[model samples]
Target: MVKFLKITAAIVILLLLFYFVFFKYRQIQANKILIPATTQTLFKINVDELYKTLAVSYLKHPSQYAGTDKNSIREKIADLNSGLRIPANIYIYALKGTAKNTLFTRLEIADTSAFNHFILKKLALLKKDAHFFESADSTFGLLVNKKTVSIAFNMAKEPIRHILEEIHDQNNMVKISDSKFAQMASLSDHLSFQDAENLSKINFTDGKIDFSSEFENKWIEPAAEPRHRMLNPESTLSFWLNGKIKSDLTEKNHTMSLSLLSKDSFFRFYQDYVDFEWTKTVTQVDTIVGYEYNDDFEQVEKKILRDRKIPSITINLNSDDKAVSNYLKSLGALDQSTGKISSAMIPLYQFYFRGSNGNVQLSTIKSAKPDVKRASSDDFFYFKVDFKKLINQTSIPLIADKLGTFSQLEIKAKSIGKNKIKLESELLFLNKDANALMQVLKVFQNGFKSALDLNLSVDIPVSK
Candidate 1:
């Protein structure tokens, strides 16, 4: 009797050990399916883990958790999860192959009985369509196995089985090439949650999602330029962008600096360049013998050599000293004392320049003394722009027409190490109650403010 009891116990222990090893191995295989071979876009959701989180939250704050019925939520969740083959993670992929546009999802099912009871049993209750042989929807297909199940939807007119077979084939997968994929995988593993990498890989074709048709050359490379160290190491943002500018003024390897200035400095520079109306001087000049009035003159001509400040504003630009000097020389800089240039140097000066001297007063536009701030480090440069002044003074039809719509605008950029730069800007509406961005801007002067707003940012990397 003792020997028989010991034998039974040993068999039970062996069975438990085998089951544990199989479960672990299955989990490893399931994770590998998250990233398929060929796919335009990928999405993942960890339903099991997410449910656990919600369950914990509900336990902590029962009042905050809302539900329509008073049924046992935990039991329902357990039943749903048990019905799913693989409840921990669900992966969704957008693929383009035999079918022009199709969506494929792979699910691992552990308990076929539970799944049938919850889904297939319920589906059985619905009347079947005789022509389609299943349900009225001809776009969906379900392939079931003892351990796994596959569901697919084809937006094209192609048969559903063809789309399902294509997704099931491992060789048909298309992979996205980017560091973002690796980062997403790392995040998913860390959090034990469902995560996605690239969903923008798809483009619309015939009102359906398809892979982008554009092809990028992988062989051609850009030649390296002699590394020019950052001018301001402590600057806010800095990076190298290798691209050609249309103008003949700058080289292909153009280094740009972004910085901020105080409100006073910004206003001072704007007023000097754009504010040019002449006021009648009250200073009494020595009476001099004047020529006799001509028939064209209405009265004693008030033309006199009156002293007035030139309409010139000095600003420290992002370019090098030599570049700044060349830019000024291009604008016909005449004054050597203060750094100032003629309004003619600025493109579209006709609309923005309000100077009375016209072409004759070109020399009157002198460079103001530049408030040059040296960079403490060779990393990045920083500067602020007064958009209010820009909107008021700039006469460029394209931007001028749009500037009045925005109530507040602020821009900031920062360099992440030597290769990447991050830029952020905000445009706020004066009326927070507005629904659309255009509406917010149009009514910005009306003192309306909305809690909702539009925001955008970008991260750029410069290759070494």
Candidate 2:
């Protein structure tokens, strides 16, 4: 009887102790990575947080970048403090996502150089030393690898092709077999007959596209330039796309490659929005995030409980997982998705983009009817976009969920036909739960409104 009482008392004490160490106290993830030979200690920062900082940057500046040298731009990161003797131990990694926008007034009135010129400007700003930074040499800046993609509308213009040939100074371009009508069909169909039919009005009659494009050479980081040995120059990554409707989109399988001016830019893109873009090009993704720590789980668990107050604890070596589950349940990130925030990847075992697509179909059914004049027999729907910007300002819940789940996800994408297409996000899970996965998908389909219909707000899932 005495032994039983003693055992009960010990169990109760241990339970209380566990709560104080894990739930009540803050937690941090500690992992291992190979760094410069000069480093004394290395810290594994959360990839999700770092990416949020970047999402915020591009979201805030919608015009895109014009130069590569962004020293002033680097100084603008609000979260990253100035004058650091060394880099912080907290390194966020793998920031990635795609924002949808419309093409307005093509550069040549007919030539669409938005992807080449405008996108370059935005990317240049993102890779600038001031933005992709570290507190010091050993301060440890994460190579934030991000990809910026935009599909141009006026791709059908013959003159636009000629101008591109002139710009590249090469006439060896091969023609892509995809048809214009098929390409445009996948985008928003709000392009009224007046817009789609009047192709002649938007095309450049001249053999050249006479539009101004800004370029900045400062995109190359001098220090990170020499360290390009990690990633292979020629490697293909795969992606999965998800939407309410199943697609037969072949061209969407091929992704546009952007070779950066510097190695730092490459890593920066990877860190900022890794597989977020690469993996979402084909179907849905079911992610699994497993921890890889330097020490054994049992020993680390004890020490983690001892030091819970100073930093914070995520579900990892120290986590039993039950505490995290309870925490997430209270936060309402479990089965019931609240909205965009509900789509976010948070805590351990979170979900993203599983909710349903808010689909809106636009069609010119009346015009194509037999009685109508000059009616063509192709499907008549193109997306219409009325929004502030294609991309958001910070790390959204969906993006945060993506970075938290996978270490190096390979995201790939290409433009789907004429539609101003907004592909759905992929799923990132800490573990595999097919049932919860299905429920999340239903939520997304019901909650998320199609970006084609209206203006949307930027959802910063983690900060709030």
Q: How close is every model to the real structure, measured as TM-score?
A: 0.35, 0.14
Model 1 — TM-score against the truth?
0.35
- Identify the candidate with maximal TM-score: 1
Tens-place lDDT per residue, model 2, 16-71, is: 89855652232221112112222111113332323333344346543322223434
Steric clash count of candidate 2: 72
How close is each model in CA RMSD to the real structure? 16.6, 31.6
* Model 1 regions lying over 4 Å from their true place: 1-29, 34-36, 48-52, 66-68, 78-82, 98-101, 117-135, 166-184, 189-464
Candidate 1 overall lDDT versus native: 0.38
The C-alpha local distance difference test score for the whole of candidate 2 amounts to: 0.24
lDDT digits (tens) for residues 231-271 of candidate 1: 23222122322222223332445332221132322222221
Lowest lDDT block of 10, candidate 1: 272-281
